[model samples]
Target: MMDMQTQPVRSQSRPVVEHGFVTESMTDTCAIVANLEHCTNTAVALQSHYAQGFLSSRHKHGRGQISYCQSGMMLVMTDEGTIIVPPGHFIWIPPNMYHQAQAQDGMCMLSIYVENGLWPDLPGNSEVFHASDLFECLMQRMIEIEEKGAFSSSTFDAIVTLIRDEIGLASRLDMSMPMPRDRRLARICNAILREPTVLRGKDELARIGNVSHRTMTRLFQTELKMTYSEWCQQALILNALARLAAGDPVTTVAMDLGYVSPSAFSAMFRRRVGCSPKEFAKQY
Candidate 1:
């Protein structure tokens, strides 16, 4: 039996607060999140730093959140999919959505929490978007205000409005990978995620899932609405994004992902990501 459980396990530790910001070093983050959700402020901003390989236990917040990755990459995993937030990008998580986060190569992030019903158009689903220069500046201002405890400042209100408008107009990135519900298919997906460079054959993957090739194909298409090969290609692209953002050399990342040559990998990355690996790395 595969015995692979795909669902996120909830943490039972009590929550703790420290330094006016929630720190993973304290305790379970649930308590701080709960307190923030009920704060009277229209929006609250907090900064957090995580070391490489840091993973937060599965949790949810009552307020919608905008998480901006300032210096590294983050992977926000929800039941629907896993969204990659590289530097210069942010992910908006809807209120009360269950999710877990992982730091890729360590990260410095700023999280903005908006009270419920503040923006009627706030998306009900999580989305990743490239942060514009102006948006980035506005977020910095918000952080300054947060540090000063100036929620009632007229300047704070003005910046919040601009931030909301920016978010509404920002370009969304297709960086998420939808997960399958079936345990057999989930097992195959997990294996690919663990070692994306392997390039396993379809029959081999099917065997690993304890299914025939055709059944495996159908499961992917039916559950994820994407063909198995297409899904794998996306998986590879996401992995490449994280690696490149982590300051990995283009050639090194290419070789690690099993590409025959840097040129070949660069070509595919350009086609899917709309930029060469070198260009993408430079942006970070």
Candidate 2:
């Protein structure tokens, strides 16, 4: 029988910070912090205070990555929109495509970069998924191996296989932000995303997009099937979800997003997400 005392416990907190953003020709931040040539599909790295957003690299490797913010958060903003990664949550960024990440707060990040081709059927793009209890345990165990330099043994191989299998069968990644395909509308969408909680008026955003307020409203309706206000509300909801995942108190997030009171925020979240912020926090 597996000994409970020997089991790895999920870390309760982390200290990672946000990275800014990167372009297509750039390399991953992993290469800068760790020895990439020595990095392996089975090897993993644990880091704290990861505060910079790495640029997007279009490189597609057979290697897949599992990144966890045990305490802080990461925003995996891809061409496909963003995936908010908070403590107890991990993001799977498949090989290739343009992808980048930003941390919301200080972070304790453990990255398991893999090469088993195990997650082919998963989303063709980046996604955030809740890490299972076993998967979280496996991640911590891998960190142990790294700290102890145990990668030379077959024990490490066993761990790798286990992780790959978990990825294959782990729950489907349920959280994602699908990108709008239209170039004109996508520009406006991206602007909102950069500063979701900010009270930037539509007329201001319209000017940023080099279009009139009327034109912007029409594009959102005719092309995206949502009104300008509706799209903005969705952006705020998504932003709130990220903030909540980062362990921010409901009162704080509500106020930061310009809500006058916690009850108002609760009402908005309930209306959009079908649950209160407290309930949503409990689910993750």
Candidate 3:
């Protein structure tokens, strides 16, 4: 409502890697997010254009955030989990939750912000939602209208309402792998994640973490709430998602992740992602 040029906001972000791994690039948060904190509107949207390797530094919003990945993949980390925002997908971020994102090559993102009191009963936690065709069309319309910055309150409000309902109807993806904070488990996870190809047995991996195999198994169950084998499979699928999103060939990704053959890899990928590797690659 007031002059748009009068607001000043600062955001801090860092390069995010697969599975919520923090990369070398990070920027500190400003004294306060100078932008958009006092806007008169209840709903707002913004589009970000970035090259490869762009990392949104760690920050939290006073309002809930909906990040749509129009192209490329965005690794968004939150306390709940690290969500993979592949093309044609969106992630729901709860208000006041710290989050960060890093995009693959030529990433374009459109985000909608809903002030806390505007919508209630939205998901209290973060989750990746598969974008439906109708939802995408509506979002595109929202982008078009918001870009013009001129619309009746009721018209824009209807779009936001539709978006919220559509998102609720959508299903979540098997994208987040439970992370452990225990030092021993963290070490093991980091080592295996560093090179997904390393098919180390539990005994050997436990040795790397300086813990007994029995101890490691117990820790995985208690800390991550999954068996070691279950956790490893999920980790590989996440890594594969990143590679496939980056446009790697299915065969190459399969081999690099230690799959005996593309067929085997494809079977696992299909089970987890509900699509063949080739289909996932085409989006990016």
Candidate 4:
């Protein structure tokens, strides 16, 4: 992904609405929208956030949101699942759907929040849509409009309608992670999250959860719907992707992430991400 710290800034127009807040320059690769108030259906606010590390908060927007990164990668988590947004790939979040997004590398994002009732055909709540050619262009246009602060007669409505239609027709891609609420299982989850690439075996997690191996297995399958090892793999892959995006070298990342060797990590990367680490790095 291109560095946000060096991306061209939007025009000098200041925000007219007191309700919308913007973080003009977040980093060399990202921006942030702290919050926006009273910004309802007809109008949506666009902002950006860039970070080199993870963002831990799970969010539920009052309206729908689309986060398209100009650079780097984003992993968005929701109750339903987690979606990986690579550069040129974005995620569409329906209204009221809880989600948390973490930066894999340093990321530059353009996020738009729409009113709840604007589009009916689209999923009522969370749906992750792959970024299509038209979809990507529309997002770029939105940036141009917002930066110029030039709202014409049909500007807002036209843009919203196009986005709504795109949402209606856009393919729903699998880019989500399911979250379990069980506190016992959650303990194991927390441990894995803290050291995703290093943790090993169900016994380790069972010890931390203070449960038998059998119990831990049952809880992991029943609550998380995946084995402990599988969950750990998923977590490690996500962490690896983030680290890779942040411009880390493969050999160093492999070592730091607990791989036995760079080749071992490369194989895992290819298996999970459908590409070698070097190939994936080129997309950013």
Give the alpha-carbon lDDT of every model.
0.77, 0.62, 0.72, 0.65
Give residue 179's lDDT in candidate 3 (0 to 100): 67
Give the winner by TM-score: 1 or 4.
Answer: 1
How are the candidates ranked when ordered by TM-score, highest leading? 1, 3, 4, 2
- For model 4, what is the error of residue 51's alpha carbon versus the real structure, in angstroms, after optimal superposition? 3.9
lDDT of 4 by residue, 1-284 (tens): 12213333233444334223233444222222234334433546465655565464555656667777778787676776566777766677887676666666567777677666665555654555656678777867766765676656477577667866776676665444455688887787777776776747778778988989999889878987887777777777767776777677999889987888999999988766656898767776
- In candidate 1, position 225 carries an lDDT of 94
Candidate 1 lDDT for residue 206: 89
lDDT of 1 by residue, 81-141 (tens): 8877878889999888999887776578877788787887977888888888998988877
Better of 1 and 3 by lDDT: 1
Sequence-dependent TM-score of model 4 = 0.72
Each model's TM-score, in the order given?
0.85, 0.65, 0.83, 0.72
**Candidate 3, which ten residues in sequence have the lowest lDDT sum?**
17-26
Deviating ranges (above 4 Å) for candidate 4: 1-37, 53-59, 75-84, 98-105, 124-127, 165-173, 249-276
Backbone clash pairs for candidate 1 read: none
TM-score of 3: 0.83
Task: Please give the lDDT score at residue 166 for candidate 4.
Answer: 74
Best by lDDT: 1
What TM-score does model 1 achieve against the real structure? 0.85
Arranged by lDDT, best first: 1, 3, 4, 2
Runs with alpha carbons beyond 4 Å of true place in candidate 3? 1-32
Off by over 4 Å in 2: 1-49, 52-61, 151-153, 168-187, 194-207, 212-230, 241-249, 255-284
Q: Kindly list the per-residue Cα lDDT of model 3 for residues 183-275, writing each as its tens digit.
A: 888899878767766789889999989999999999999998889888888778767887887667899989988889999999988777777
Best by TM-score: 1
